[model samples]
Target: MKTQVAIIGAGPAGLFLGHLLKAEGIDCVVIERQTPDHVLSRIRAGVLEQVTVGLMERLGLDARLKAEGLVEGGFNLADGERLIRIDCQGLTGKTVVVYGQTEITRDLMEAAPSRGLEVIYGVGDVAVHDIESDAPYVTWTKDGSAGRIDARFIIGCDGFHGPSRKAIPASAAREFERVYPFGWLGILADVPPCHDELIYANHERGFALASMRSHTRSRYYIDVPLTEKVEDWSDDRLWDELAIRLGPDAAANMTRGPALEKSIAPLRSYVFEPMRHGSLLLCGDAAHIVPPTGAKGLNLAASDVHYACEALAGWFKRNDADAVAGYSERALARVWKSERFSWSLTKLMHRFPEDGPFERKMQVAELEYIASSVAAQAAIAENYVGLPV
Candidate 1:
């Protein structure tokens, strides 16, 4: 197979990039190691920053999202007993959309074919060759047969665990990371959210968050030790812990049901210095990862796709190498900001094992400042809603 650009991964970032490139009249193909069913079945965060929503609209893919997604105007920061509300719309004139990542992937997958985009799934032994040269090609195997795609550029949207990042030589990339001592044990249930807005709590025990995917579906999480296992948490036990951490009011109003999905996700902050090496460029989780505290993971992916599309389009249309040449730096600038936001939020909301009484007091003081000061709230709102792409 031959194409102008080859995209590795069928996640939202790759799919969105392919759709955007096709709209720009650029030929592109997506390669994935997972089946479409497997991709769509994975559960992920739902909060959509304003910019991400705008991109979906630009792609003519926001009808379902606009109708079904919950519009969140604000969120709450709680220090166990007291809740501090940050008015997102008031501070930034923007609101986030609560549309699951799975839905976004489904929308892109459904729209790809109609837009003349191509994708190959269930492949093995995927590798990149001659990425430093003007011409780059990708190879894989499917059903005991070898496959190859010769393209002008190869994009790695394959995520943190994917092969794309590993293909980049270690000498060409500088890695930075911080693995937190805790993880989030989350559950999805078919029950209305206890509150209209998401509530993030910093309790004596740990951290807890009350969120929702829709009007009737609730998603909640509690901070847990890295050594904890999901099997260690029963539905009843989890609920008891959540209610205690959420405080009196929310706990009293909270309803519980059988969990549809449950899992433990470790918190981490990771990034590669430059997102590009030769004709092989990385996007989204392939390049960096942020803790879920700031809800920046999927949003960052969308922004990366936007930048990639712009860079590729500029390269093909005007023979301008500037955008392509600077893609890494430009994308890294935004990525670092998000990482800071996620890191800050994580620190503020979670109780670290190393935190002394002084550190806990500091966290409380910071939350108090954010609650009392308009300037502080605005800063949090601006970053939470997302920085410009």
Candidate 2:
């Protein structure tokens, strides 16, 4: 098979890229190693910045999103019993929506067939070849059958553990990473949210977050040691901890329920430089990763896809080679900004084992400053809502 672009992975990044290219009359094919069901089953971030929502709108797949997504004007930061609210809309003239990443993926996936975007799922041993040349290809096997796609460009949206990023020679790239000592133990349940807006609390106990997937589906989390096991805490235990850490106001409205999904996700900040290696361009987790503290993971990926689409469009349609050559520098600028925001929020809201009296005081002082200063609030709101594309 031949195409202008071969996208590896059918997750949001890959799917978004495929749809964007196809919209511009550029032929692209998506390859996936997992079944569609498995891909949608993975739990992920629910917050959506304007950039993400804009992409959905551009693809004309936002009917469900606009109807169901919870529009949040602002969110709160908790210092024990106090809730310091940052008015994102007032400060930045923008707001975010509470929509699950799975829903976005489903919208894109469902719209693909109608829009003539082809995705090959449930393939194995997927690999990229000859990325150093103008002509590159992707190969995979399934059910004892082998398949190949020859393309002018191979996009590695296959994620951190996938084979796409590894295809780039180590000598041509640089990696930066910081693994946090604690992980977020989250619970997803079918119940009303405790609060109208999301809350990030930094209590003496630890860090806790109160969020929602919808009016009836609540998602909450608390930072726990990486060594802790999920089995150690039952549904009741986790709920109890959330109530205590989120403080009295949120606790009063909180409803206890059985866990629909519960697990511990480790936190990390990772970036692989030079997103483009010859004909292979990296997107989403293939190029970068940010902790979920600031809800930048999915939004960051959307921004990457937006840039990737533009670069590819420029290359094929306008016959501009510099756009492809400059893809890395362009994407990295926004990637680093988001990484900083996520890391900063994580530090402000989490109780680290290595942190002592001074660190605790610093967290308190910083939160206090943010609450009192509109300038401080604006800075956060700007990044939270996302920078311009």
The list of candidate 2 runs beyond 4 A from truth reads none
lDDT of 2 at 306: 95
Report the error of model 2 at residue 311, Å. 0.7
lDDT per residue (tens digit) for residues 222-263 in model 2: 999999999999999999999999999899999999999999
Per-model clash counts, in order, read 0, 0
State the lDDT of candidate 1 residue by residue for 1-389, as single tens digits: 89999999999999999999999999999999999999999999999997789889999999999899999999999997689999999999999999999999999999988999998999999998999999999999999999999999999999999888988899888999999999999999999999999999999999999999998999999999999999999999999999999999999889999999999999899998689999999999999999999899999999988889899999999899998999999899999999999999999999999999999999989988897899999999999999988
RMSD, one per candidate, in order: 0.7, 0.6
Instruction: Give the Cα lDDT of each candidate.
Output: 0.94, 0.95
The most accurate candidate by lDDT is 2
TM-scores vs. true structure, each candidate: 0.99, 0.99
